[model samples]
Target: MIAPAPGISLGIDIGGTFTDLVLHDPALRRSGSLKILTTHADPVQGILEGTRRLLGEASVEPGEITRVVHATTLFTNALIERKGALTALITTAGFRDILKIGRERRYELFDLMLRPPAPLMPDALRLEVPERVKADGTVVTPLDLAALDAAADQAVAAGAEAIAILFLHSDLHPAHEEQAARRIAARHPGLSVTASHAIVREMREYERGCTASANAYVAPMAGRYLARLGAELAAMGIAGPLLLTLSNGGMTHVEEAIRAPVQLLESGPAAGALAAAYLAGAQEPRILAFDMGGTTAKLSVVEHGEPEVVFGFEAARQARFIEGSGLPIRISTVDLMEIGAGGGSIARRDAIGLLKVGPDSAGSEPGPACYGRGGLEATVTDANLLLGYLDPSRFAGGRLPLDRRAAQAAMARLAAALGITAEAAAWGIHDVVTEAMASAARTHLAERGRDASGFTLVCTGGGGPVHGYHLARKLGIRRVIVPPEAGVASALGLLTAPPRVDRVATLGRRLLAWRAAELEAAFAALEAEARGVLARGGWAEDAPAPERVVDARCVGQGAHMPVTLPPAPWPTDDAALHAMITEAFTAAYQERFRRPPPAVPIDLVHARIVLRGAARPLALPPARRGWEGPATAHQRQILSGGCSAMADIYSRPGLMPGFSARGPALVEESGSTLVIGGKGRFSVLENGNILVELDA
Candidate 1:
């Protein structure tokens, strides 16, 4: 085995259907990638196999891999499948129902049968201790140790595997929660303790409690999986640091990831967004990143070479698109909107006798009908296959042969139900999913006050390039960029990601009564905590200066907006600091709302710092091995404008830079396929990205 080299890195991303592996050797400015069906029962088995095969094919030594970056849907699946460990929550007296009583608001106001998501921890498992803290951080009723002991004992006796502590006002004063965590750990050595303050350190009992309990629920399981994977990789003669990507588009050491698995809930999608940003950051600074995998479509906005980050997001959503219809988790995550529109999204007829395509998927176990996995339901992939958008012989690099007859049978069943031809039903399924994705993109960009029409679209994932053309057209987006190795882009993104950590503290204070000394101390503490977390990865010293932002709002406002501090040194003078913050707030508010702040005092809610270690530079191959013959490999009929047309098929690598083609044309690669409409004009860029321009 060769010695470890700084230029060699490997990345693995496990999605709903596929496990993608990318081995990058920057010294050679080349990357080798592979995709295999995900092994849900033991995801590490697939990862190990994929990693070994990739290295073997490239004739590379396992010991040469300097680092391994990975992202998985394991913990996220656990939450959604309700397969996590038996968890229990302990809160302040009279607050045992906080998780159930989430703001007392219905996500669906008009629906009488609106059912919120069930709590991860049931009522029977939630127990409160004798403790009370005033909203102002003053202890009212001291914590009763005997009461805490009784609750812990009762919970353990009832078969609780993990415990969560969420005391009232713990965001402001974590003493009680910390003490309870210590006691619980000492008494129950086998149980994992997740304290709310340690998880969120912010206000809102329901959200913080949900985050803590969810973390505790998945911590033990995540720890064991990480340990097993790490041990197996080491046994494979691979000497490298193992890291996992977070929902915030940051990569952290396996230890940190195991400690807080909830932060990884949406990690798989985050990698795709990061990859899109890096691939198109220079060509198009602002873009709508569209990643369509097997089971879901993830969309995010990237501006100025960075994907936006949200302080909180919902998980295991009951209603896939509706906000607040899922477990509220307050952790930093890439700002993304996910819709149940993907290759394997099952297509069916709704109660209204109208056609609907997914929020339900066939997934890997019994993927699409075309996979010949005993799936009889019509799915997006089946539709695409029937529409000739995919080459059955070369799908998944011919590793998994597609059965056209199976897809036809599935589409025929749906077509018969809708009283339409199998071909018509296939087109309908395609358009329905596209419309769903476009509608979601419109809403997501509008919520951020962004214009989808003004942004280019960067397509990634297995299904992204196939639907991106129509999705862009629907949104009035003129330009779309398809990067190299588009199907495994998320796994590739893991290689480009840097070590990052976000630390937040709830500092509910009035900006009017600013105390520079106290605020500085708080900032110091938050930054230190963030640094310490990064230190475990041996990357703190090389990281760039951390970014500072505060969540603030008018005293009477219902929601707080995050305000980025202007580039300046830490202020010492109270008046100067106040002025600086006030100006920054007004400017940001004006930009967002087109108006100045209301005539009310501004309240600072949370202080946050994001520490980003420098990413190892990734080199895109200057060119690829293209077909020696004509670019047009063959001609296939594709549905264009709800009509059939013979589209010229081209292999992706066959098209060189400055090569231009007019559609209808299909660009096929081993990883993904791009469908260009008749009105589209496309070209290959110098870096091997296919740039598409569509006329409205």
Candidate 2:
């Protein structure tokens, strides 16, 4: 067994509104955490400030930190805000329109004015060179190196800071794309070069091209930010390697992350899902991991102790719920749904005078009016304050006090506009946002062919616990689990993620025609590449055997289903291996479509391998020795179900395992609050997590 490193391991997650930090001391079995508003202009500023505060409060020295895992939405924000570096794309001749053409499918068919997301690179910057590689890995038209070099020079002269090289069928034969990348990098030493094959080996030229372009677009900015963050940490006397959490719920070295920033698009939300899986999966395998932060609410599913993962996702959509309206990124990501209905989500009357909760957020700069951060608009946070769900004196652990008057004043405007009382308006805002989240969750689960009734809702983030009970009731979920350190759950997730690398290669071939030796070789090659990546990320020892998955589809079908195969050292007999693959595909197809297709030929579309290293077990502070009595810290009047009532307010720290309370009640912790509606019951679990069960 490899001995674990000594000292503290820090996990930092920068969200849309707050930068959360968690410092765990394995030796002492203790953890300290903090949350600070994110600095919009410079995110690192918030990170640095939060880091300093956490360490100081914990009385730990910088040198005591052995490792730091960081996750952020900065790259995603860059893509959404269009603040990334100037970038260009170079592809095979005649494929310059691939980005623009983009599958040519309308996400919304009935809408006459449906608009697709704009390509990262404009037509003028999407230069193409003569290069073509056949689907069978044969070079049809050799790459025009001189022409590529000239085009690269011209792109650089045109102020392209990064260039994405994507040749036709590069997934089948990457030599041309790789050579063009080399030529561009050699000619322009400082320019960032992204080859599609390096980012994704899957087929589908348009998605691959989009992923490569997005990577190149964010590479320069991500690199600069990471470099600056590393230097800053080093200057603070912490010398540990800085790791980054990926959208796929794994940790990789900063170097690897900077090279493919597209993988970091869902980094922050992925961590929250990981945390949910880690903390609640043992008790409930099927869990709805709901995280409501300051700016957004994300819902992911965890089944059988693992979060659901998807091969590709769309980002920065013009229409939030529409699939094809955003940029397609072909990278493995935790499958989740995000909606802008967080605490900082702006709430106001729409043009028709109907109250509307966000898809727009005030964020941290001028957060909710209750935050007293210069924001005049009412938000979910302000509404919560007006409803007495949030205590003005104890918000955010009292690091930032809530202004009750400001909150009331802000909501009063909306109330006046609606001809309702401020409290009534606050309830409307709260109900709208909660319903929005529940609706999104329902849609997400329905799309996966799952129902929310049987799954437990594990809530995290600043607003998650506060709203968990109501959301659970709406979703027909009886139980909701709010883990310890829920407000900083994403940061805690960063600590729980194992070092993993997922790699895939396009392998378009009929199952019956495949050679055992060739198939084995392909799997072996992918495993080797994944292992190399894990080694570079400092997890060389004790890496587990790679898990293999095949993307298979019936011949002539455009879509494919991922089928997990048995562990490696595949059968040597061709018939046995073929049968094994066929059975798995048939079973998966039956499960999804209710029955297997009539006897038909199946083809392997992509071969995937995931290499995972054993994650270090995190030792949370042990639960209190014994349960005390009711332990009511105080009593407060709270509005619930349109009725005002005096509720027992309990301090979370004072409650021990087996301690139970009945609602209406407020369980107060430093960074978060758990609200239990009328007839609801909450109990502290063995792991110090709060499990709230709502009455039917």
Pairs in steric clash, model 2? none
How many clashing residue pairs are found in candidate 1?
0
lDDT of 1 by residue, 330-426 (tens): 9999999998888889999889888999988999989999999899999999999989999999998888889999999999999989989998899
Q: What overall lDDT goes with each candidate model?
A: 0.89, 0.90
Each prediction's TM-score against the native? 0.98, 0.98
Worst 10 residues of 2 by lDDT: 624-633
Instruction: Show model 1 residue runs off by greater than 4 Å.
Output: 1-5
- Candidate 2 per-residue C-alpha lDDT over 346-394 given as tens digits, one digit per residue, 9 for 90 to 100: 9888899889999899999899998887999999999888888988888
Which whole-number lDDT from 0 to 100 does residue 61 have in model 1? 98
